[model samples]
Target: MYVYRSHDQQLLNERVAQFRDQTRRYLDGQLSDDEFLPLRLQNGLYIQRYAPMLRVSVPYGMLSSTQLRALARVARQWDKGYCHVSTRQNIQYNWPALEDVPDILAALADVEMHAIQTSGNCIRNVTTDEFAGINGKEIEDPRPWCEIIRQWATFNPEFAYLPRKFKIAVNAVPDEDPALIGVHDIGVQVLQRDGETGFRVLAGGGLGRTPMTGEVIGEFVPWPDLLAYLEAILRVYNKYGNRDNKYKARIKILVKALGAEKFRALTEAEFAELKDGPMTLTAEEVDAMRSHFSAPAYDAIDDQPPALQDALASDKAFNRWYHTNVTRHRQAGYAAVTLTLKKTGRAPGDITDEELEAVADLADQFSFGEARTTHQQNMVLGDVRQDQLFTLWQRLDALGFATPNLKLLTDLVACPGGDFCSLANAKSLPIAEEIQRHFEDMDYLHDLGPIDVNISGCMNACGHHHIGHIGILGVDKKGREYYQITLGGRGDKTSRIGEKLGPSFDTEQVVPIIARLIDLYVEQRQPGEQFIDTYERLGIDPFKERAYATDH
Candidate 1:
C-alpha cells in the first residue's frame, strides 16, 4: 500500500475542510441545488432513491487494514451497519445523511482515503488487476503506474469536467484482461519488448446504453511519454465529445462516431504538441512510485507444504474453499485468497461492519496488513501463506466469507439497484439473490464450471452485465419489472459484449429461465466444457430457444 506523503496528507485535509464548508452552505440553504450539485458530486456524495449515497475511492482497489477499519467505522456510525462494494472496486454507503458526508470524508482522510473523482463527469478511479503486484504472469507491477495516473488525474484542472464520466484500467499481465481493460474508456496494457518498457493504449471502450470494446489508439506508447500520451487522448475526447446529450456523451460514442482511425490521428496530432513536454515521466519518478509498492519480506517455504496437503486431505470443506477461493501468487508459499461477498440471502457485494472489522483483523494476521477490493465485488487477501490456508478458511467461514463460489454462477456481480439507486429501472438485488438461491448446489455449480453472472438494474451497466458469461439486466415494462438476458459475453482476454435473448421476463420468471439456460448447457456441453465454451460453440440460438421455451 502507498503511504501518503506530507503533501498528500495536506491535500486531502484541505479538500475535506473545503467540502465540509460546501456541505454546510448547502444545508443552510446558502447554495442552490444547481450550485451544490456539482460540488457534492465532486466530493462523492449523491442523492440516491432514499438517502444520500457516499462513494469512497479505493485507489486501484488497494486498502490497508487501517483503511478497512476506517470504512467499518463509517458504516457503523454514519450509514447502515453494512456497506456495498461497487463493480468498480469502490465502496458505497447507501444511507448517509447529506450533512454527514463531509464528516465521513474527513474520517476517510484520516486513513489516507477520499472520494474525490469517484463520481461526476471526470476521470474516475484508475482500476487495475487486484493481483497486480503479486501475479506471476505480469510484465510489470501496474500499481506504481496506476498511482502515477491517479496523481495526475486527480484535481487536474484540464479535465475536471469531461463530457461524461471516464474510466481507465491498467493490465500488466500478458494475454489476460483480468482488470476488464477492454471495456474501459482508456485501457493501458503494460508491455515490455527489447528490454524496454512501453504501453499499448486502447481507447473508446465502454458499456451502458452503447456497449463496445476499445480500439488500440497507440500501438506502442513509450514509458517516458505515458502521461503526455494519456493527456492527448483526453484532449481529443474533451474537444469533440457530445455535451448536448448525456446519453451519447461517453468517449465510446465519440470514438465510434469519428472512427478509430480518425480518432487515432487526432490523438497523434495532440501527442505531437505535448510529447516530451513537462508531463513526460522520468525514470526517477517511476521508481519513486514503485518504492511505495515494494514487495513484502516473504518467508522461504515450499509452495505445497506438508501441513497444507494434510489439511486438504483431511477436511473436504477446507479443500473446496481452497481450490475455489485461493489463487496462485507470484511468491512461492503465498497465495491470494478472495473473501466471497456473494452469499445467498444477502445482496451481492454487501459486507457488514462486523465483517469488515473481522476482515481487517484477518488481513493484519495473514496478508501483512494489506488487502484489495476486486472489480468483481469481493475482498482479496493478496499475500496469505500457503501453510495457514486451513486456519484462514475456518476464520473466513465463521465470518460467512467462505462461500466457495469464485467465478461460479452463484458468485455474481450486481449493483444496488432500485432499492438504493434512483437511476435504476428495477430492483437488481432481488434478482441476484434469486439467482444465487437457485444455484446453491455446490457439486452442481462445480460441475457446471467457472461462469460469470452479472446483473444490473438498468442500462447503466454498473454491474457490468455486458461482460458476464450470462448477463441479466433489469428493465421496466409498463411500470412492471422485467429482466432481459444475454449469453456468451465474457471479460477475459476474449472480451465481448453479450448477445441478448429475446423478450424480457417478469421477476418470478427470471430464476426458472436461468435454470432452463443452465439445463441446456448441462445437456449439450461436452466433457470439460464450461458454460461459456458451450454457449460459444453452439451460439445464442440454442440457449435463447431453450430459455424462452414454454415448458421452462
Candidate 2:
C-alpha cells in the first residue's frame, strides 16, 4: 500500500475543512441545494432512498489494517453498525446522517483514506485485480501504475466533470483479466515487448442501459507516454461526449457514435501534440511509485508444505474451502484467500463493524497487516502462508467468512438496490438471497460449476449484470417489480454482453425461473463443463425455451 506523504495528508485535511464549511453552509441555507449537490457528490456523499450513503475509496482495492480499523470505528460511531463493500472495491456506509459525513471523511483521512471522486462525473477510483501484485501470471505489478494514474486523475482540472462518470481499470495478467478492464471507460493492459514496457489501451467500454465492451484505441502506448495518451483520450471524450442527454452522455456512446477508428484517430492526433509534454513519466518517477510498494519479506520455503498437505488430506471442510476460496500466489509458500461476503441471508458485501475489526486482526496476524477488497464484494488476505491455511480457515469459519463458494452460483454479485439506492427500480437483495437459499447445498453448488450470477436493480448495471453468465436485471413494469434474465455473458479474457432470454418475470417468479434455468443447465452440460461453457455451446435458445416453458 502507498503511504501518504505530508502533501497528501495536507490535501486531505484541506478538502475535509472545505467540505465541512460547504456542508454547514448548506444546512444553514447559505448554500442552495443545487450549489451543494456537486460539492457533496465530489466528496462521495449521496442522498439515497433513505439516508446519505458515503463511499470511501480503496485505491486498487488496497487497505491497511489501520485503515480497516478506522472504517470499523466510523461505522460504529457515525453510521450503521455495518458497511457495504461496493463492486468497485469501495466501501459504503448506507445509513450515515447527512450532517456527519464530513466527520466521517475526517476520520477516514486520519487513516489515509478518503472518498474523493468516488461519485462525481470524474475518473473514479482506479481499480485493478484484487491480487494485482500477488497473481502468479502477472507480467508486472499493475498497482504502481494504478497509483500513478490515481495521482494524475484525482482532481485533474480538465476532467473534474465530464459528460458522465468515467472509470478506468488496469490488467497485467496475460491469460486472464480478473480486473474486468474490458468494461471500463478506459482499460489498460500492462505489457512488455522486446525488453520495452508499454501498454495496450482500450476506450469506451462501459455497462449501463447502453452496455458495450471497450475497443482498442492505442495498440501500444509507450510507458513514458501513458498519461499523455490517457489525456488525449479524455480530451476527445470531454470535447465530443453528449452533454444533452444524461442517458447518452457516456464515452461509450461517444465512441459508438464516432466509431472506434475515428476515435482512435482523434486520440492519436491529440497524443502527437502532447507526446513529450510534462505529463510524460520518467524512470525516476516510476521507480519512486514502485518504491511505495516494495515486496514483503518472505521465508524461503516450498509450497504445499507437510502441514498444508496434512490439513488437505485430513479435513474435508478445509479442503473444500481451500479449493474454493483460496488462489495461488506469486510467492511460493503464500496464498490469497477470499473471505466471502455472499453468505446466505446476508446482503451480499455487507460486513458488520465487528467483522471489519476481525478482518483487520486477520490481516495483522496473517497477511502482513494488509487486506484487499475484491470486485466480487469479498475481502482478501493476500499474503497468507500455505502452512497456516487450516488455522486461517478456522478463524474465518468462526467469523462466518469461510463460505467455500467462490465463483459458485451462491457467490453472486449484486448491488444495494431499492433498499438503499433511490435510482433502483426494484429491490435486488431479496432476489439474491432467494437464489442463495435455493442453492444452499454446497455439493449441488460445486457440481453446478463456476457461474457468475450478477443482479442489477436497474439499467445502471452496478451489479455488472451484463457480464454475468446468468444475468438478472430488475425492471419496472407498470409499477410492478419484474426481472429480465440474460444468458452467455462473461467478463473475462473474452468479454461479451449477455443476450436476453424472453419477457420479464415478476418477483415471486424469479427464484423458480432461476431454478429452472439451473436445472436445464445441469441436464444439458457435457462432461466436466462449466455453466458458461455449456451456455456458449448451446446458446440462448435451449435455455430460453426451457426457462419460459409452462409446468405440465
Candidate 3:
C-alpha cells in the first residue's frame, strides 16, 4: 500500500477545511440549496431517500490497517454502526446526518483519506483489479499508473465537471481483465512492447440506460505520452459530449454518435498536439510512482506448504473456501484470499464496525497490515501465507466473512435500491436476498458452477447488471415493484451487454423465474459447462420459454 506524502496529507486537510466552511455556510442560510448541491456532491455527500449518504474514497481499493481502523471508528462514531462497500471500490455510510458530514470528512483526513471526486459530474475514482500486485499473471502492478492518473485528474480545472460523470480503469493482466475496463469511460491495458512499458487505450465505454464496451483508440501509446493521450480523449469528450439531456450526456453516447473510427481519429489529432506537452510522463516520474508500491520481502519456500494440503483434507468447509476464495499469488508460499461479503440476508457489502475491525486485525496478522477491496463487493488480503490458510479461514469464519462463494450464483452483486436511494424505482436489496436464500446450499451452488448475478435498482446501472451472466433490473409497473431479467452478460476481457428475456416479472415472481432459468441451464448444459457458456451456445430461447411460463 502507498503511504500518503506530506503534500497528499496537506491537500486532504485543506479539502476538509474548505468543505467544513461550505457546510457551515449552507446551514447558516448563507448559501442556497442550489449553490450547495454541487459543492456537497464534489465532496461525496448525497441526500438519499432517507438521510444523507457519504461516500468515502478508497483509492484503487488499497487500504492500510490504520486506514481501516479509522474507517471503523468513523462508522461507529458519526454514522450508523456499519458501512457499505460500493461496486466502484468505495465505501458509503448510508445514515449520516447532514451537519456531521464535514466532521466525518475531518476524521477521514486524519488518516490520510478523503471523499474528493467520489461523486458529481467529474472524473470518479480510478479503479483497477483488486489483485493487481499479487496476481501471478499480471504484467506489472497497475496501481502506480492508477495513482498517477488519480493525481492528474483530481480537481483538474479542465475536468471538474463534464457532460456527465466519467470513469477510468486499467488492466495489466494479459490473459484476463478483472477490472471491468470495458465498461469505463477510459480503459487502459498496460503492455510491454520491446522492453518498454506502454499502454493500449480505449474510450467511450460505460453502463446506464446506454451500455457500451469501450473501443480501442490507441493500440500502443508510449508511457511518456500516456497522460497527454488521456487529456486528448477527455478534451474530445468535454468539447463534443451531449450537454442538452442528462440521459444522453455520457461519453458512451458521444462514442455512438460519432463512430469509433471517427472518435479515434479525433483523439489522435488532439494527441498529436499535446504529446510533447508538460504533462508527458517522464522516466523519473514513473519510477517515483513505482517506488510508492515496492514489493514486500518474502521467505524462500515452495508454492504450497505441506500443512495446507493436510488441513484441506481434514476440513470440508475449509477446502471449499480454499478452492473458491484463494487465488495464486506472485510469490511462492503466499496466497491472495477474497473474503466474500455476499452472505445471505445481510445487505451485500455491508459490514458492521466490529466486523470491519476484525477484518482489519486479520489483515494486520495475515496480510502485512494491508488489504484491498474488490469491484465485486469483497475484501481481499493479498499476502496471506499458504501455511496459515486454515487459521485465517477460522478467523474469517468468526468474523462472518467466510462465505466460500466467490463467483458462485448466490454471490450476487446488488446496489442499495429503493431502500436507500430516492432515484430507485424498486427495491433491489430484498430481491438479491430472496435469490440468495433460494440458493443458499453450498453444494448446489458449487455444482451449478461459476455465474454472475447482478441486480440494479434502476437504469443508473450502479449494480452493473449489464455485465452479469444473470442480470436483474428493478422496474416500476403500475406503482408496484417489478424486475426485468437479462442473460449471457459478462465483464471480463470479452465484455458485452446482456440480452433481455421478454416481459418483466413482479417482485414475488423474480425468485421462481430465476430458479426456472437456472434449472433450465442445469438440464440443457453440456458436460462441465457453466451457465454462461450454455446460454451463449444455445441462445436465450430455452431459458426465455421456461422463465416466462405462466403456468408457474
- Models, CA RMSD each: 0.9, 0.8, 1.0
Summarize candidate 1's per-residue lDDT along 127-238 as a digit string, tens digits: 9998989999999899999999999999999998899999999999999899998999999999998998999999999999999999999999999999999999999999
Instruction: Residues 74-166, candidate 2: write the lDDT tens digits.
Output: 999987799999999999999999889888899999999999999988899999999988998999899999999999998799998799999
Q: What is the lDDT of residue 241 in candidate 3?
A: 94
- lDDT score at residue 513, model 2, on the 0-100 scale: 85
Clash pairs detected, candidate 3: none
Clashing pairs in 2: none
Q: Model 3, 1-552: lDDT tens per residue?
A: 667889899988899889999999999999999999888998999999889999999999999988899999999998789999899999999999999888889889998889999999999999999999888789999999999999999888999879999999999999677898888999999999998999999888998998989989999999999999999999999999999999999998999899999999999999999989898888898899999898887778787789899999999999999999999999999999999998788888888898889888998899999999888898999999999999999988987788899999988899999999998988999999998889998899999999999999999989999999999999988899999999988986567899999999889989999999999999999998999999999999988889877787
TM-score of 3: 0.99
Instruction: For residue 154, give model 2's deviation from the true position in Å.
Output: 0.9
Clashes of each: 0, 0, 0
**Which candidate would rank higher by lDDT, 1 or 3?**
1
Global lDDT of model 1 = 0.92
At residue 133, candidate 3 shows an lDDT of 89
